[model samples]
Target: MTPSTTHAQHPVGSGFTPASTVDDVLEGIDLTGKNVIITGGHSGLGLVATRALAKAGARVTIGSRDTDRAEQAVSGIGDVEVRQLDLLQPDSIDAFVARYLDSGRPLHILINNAGFPGLGGIVRDARGYEAQFAANHLGHFQLTLGLYPALRAAGGARVVTTTSGAQRVSDILWDDPHFTTGRYDPGLAYPQSKTANVLFTVELDRRWAADGIRAYAPHPGIVPATAFNRSVGEEAQRAMGLIDASGEPVIDPDRGKKTPEQGAATIVFAATSPLLADIGGVYLNNSDISPLDEDPRPVDLTDPDTEVPVDVVPHSIDPRSARRLWELSERLIKSPSA
Candidate 1:
């Protein structure tokens, strides 16, 4: 069957809700003999996904900047291995891909789950590209392209990139994505990278679906226990209603707040759901495809009552923009320093 060309950003009634856990998504699904690699699979939502996928009978490999820490974190998980992968470094990405391909394993799933929240003030990589853009988007871009052989060899594969609702807040800063001209704000930079993720997914699926490789960008919702949220400090978390006055996490999946297991549901769904076999190049949220919502709204993080929009926006899924970003990313990765 041919893949669908339409980028329909609407729910398919996945039968899973925002509160669904990883086990819920993996229910009645068997991944035995499947080979999967997940970036940052040893921590937070990634870790939860790793455990769930591994439990489903897949041989899982985790790519982490800190192999020692990743190993310790996944020590209890069976059928899982950890490898060194620093997304900030091109050589590290290449090395990780090389080692995986050398094993001659057909990769059934590749989850680009590692990300830089861009909490610290503007940071740049060796290529002088914005750290968040470089690590979160370009690094995964290079990694996925490098693993093309294995993915194609699998005959059927899925690439799930961990995006966020933040994609709604900003489009790609096409003029100066690296923030080379204006003052760099982590707030803007992080969302720009996230938008790039969705764009990358759109273009990837369009290009590779013929080869039986599909792509997905899933918003895991607001997982407060993640290192990204924890770094914001307790006071700020409280102000955002991520936590209470007593420092307890607020589990409200409807408003995007969720536990780690709940947050990983959509990601796992994107990777394994049979319902999505014919669908590609769509943004997912709450364990299902999100409907397009271009409604403009302020992203006031301080306002706990404000429900942040998690739906797909036109700019992020625009074919022209997606193609443009793919070309731009190609140039960026081919630069003399890159």
Candidate 2:
């Protein structure tokens, strides 16, 4: 299980398929007394996962930028609460972590589910870092580090980060992650951040596995109903076959388009599955570990017939790059202008 050896990238044949819903993966699992925190748990797949986890008896806490909206969204969902967390703001992330830790509760699961697609144009946080990279990767990095004590206190914890199939398309733009030097492309920025998510998982597992805390990155298949896809605009979505001529969502699990429930299956599976009790640092898709696919073919979004490659690529799972990313993230979060 050395870092260079694929990090157990092969599938374990979990007996689940792309069509499996959240309920399917959580069939007999009981999460009594478990304390979980999910970012962006008020909407889209996050909302679906929050309801399902709460139904399974886990006390779920949601981190959202708007507490009022979050509370309203989770209304009637038992054993769930919401707190303010703006991932693009470093102070906000720290404050959220502090509030949770002060409660003296052990964190059984942490889902880094919130993300920014960087759809229309370039947006930067106060630190001038790219918004997608800042929020999706660095913000979660800080929160996880802040919650280290609570995770260790739980004795065994799992951290699941919601990545995307887009990770296959790009690695880190090592020279200029924030688009400081080159022309900004939203397409490249989003994929770079998603790739960071998987690399972060790989490095986190390597550093924390001995502490009884394991990490996973789940590529919840494309769900057109999510705000992520909606931000792409209806015309573009239809062009990509995510929606039909009449604008209804295209539901094809085998081809990666899925309902919200189906999209969340792998997320909760990574969080609670006993099947992965011995595995960590791998990318998951369709409710199972994804096999390594190193093919260099570029993704084609315009062709509806071409299937997007979502498997783990070498750049996203490379041990050396993972370690380097960990160090780079540490530096970026510490510096005021980074």
Candidate 3:
């Protein structure tokens, strides 16, 4: 099946708004006794998501590569637990999932929220995969497949991956997923991983939705000042016009170009909102079904779906490509029925 070009469709009065905060999206939606896991939940939009989910009475577990940073990220969030799981490290993913499953607690929500930004220089993982691709797409791919049994056990569980407007840049370079053959263009590489993110959701949803497991990709919007910017140097930040002449970040660390609270609304809505029960395997932004225009120009400032047009266009979500991508991705990840 092809991915759906339509934005994540929900009822007319789902009570979610463009400016809705995570808390607002979850208002009156109880998550008591639920088990939710958010990667990179220790900081940025993930932290806000953790706070909202926990406050709604769910047991929120955060997966972070750095235990200390993860602990620090959820310090003020109530009843939050942190675990060690770096998406780039396959062994770490396995170990963490083994431990979590050992607890016999079913996983209700798996938010593939952790991601690394583009490091301008050509970098490789231990496996020699491109850093941006490895950390952003492949790592999450491995983690999701590793946790498939747990997700299935949870039944009705949802897996929401954090994709971006950058995905519109290009499709997966199937011949060179590692970027060994071509020049490593940071702009293009980052968008490729994002596109992979959306594709993963599309494929995952198609494969697992019948079992009551659903998948979604969300553009959390442009969040600045998070660790995601660590690889994005000061010069690049300045180049993007995100900094001031004094060299200070124009926005506060807690605040992004958008508020952290507002940035997390879409993910929160996807996780618990009843409005989306019928909508899965789609890309969403600002709590609406985004429209895509094929001929957006440079600096057109279109919706997330239109921003990265390399792989998925307004009409890109068709049955053929969605299923084809699913098969290809499963083969690449060596996932069983991914």
User: Please, what are the lDDT tens digits per residue for candidate 3 over residues 1-338?
Assistant: 22233444333455555567887788789888899988998888888899999999999999998899789767877778999988777788889889888889888899999888666587877766778887887778878887888888887899999887776667667677677878777767887788788777877888899878888787776655555753477877666545666666554322224467877888888788787787788777765444454454464433322332222354334445556666665575553222
* Candidate lDDT (C-alpha), each: 0.92, 0.93, 0.73
Clashing pairs in 2: none
Clashing pairs in 1: none
Cα-based lDDT at residue 261, candidate 3: 83
TM-score of every candidate:
0.96, 0.97, 0.85
lDDT of 1 by residue, 105-149 (tens): 999999999988777688889889999999999999999999999
Ten contiguous residues minimizing lDDT sum, candidate 1: 1-10
Superposed on all Cα atoms, model 3 deviates from the true structure by an RMSD in Å of 4.4
Model 1 whole-model lDDT (C-alpha atoms): 0.92
| lDDT head-to-head 1 vs 3, winner | 1
Candidate 2 lDDT, 182-278, residue by residue in tens: 9998888999999999999999999999999999999999999898898889988988888999999999999999999999999999999999999
Judged by lDDT against the true structure, how good is candidate 2?
Answer: 0.93
Deviation in Å, model 3, residue 54 alpha carbon = 0.7
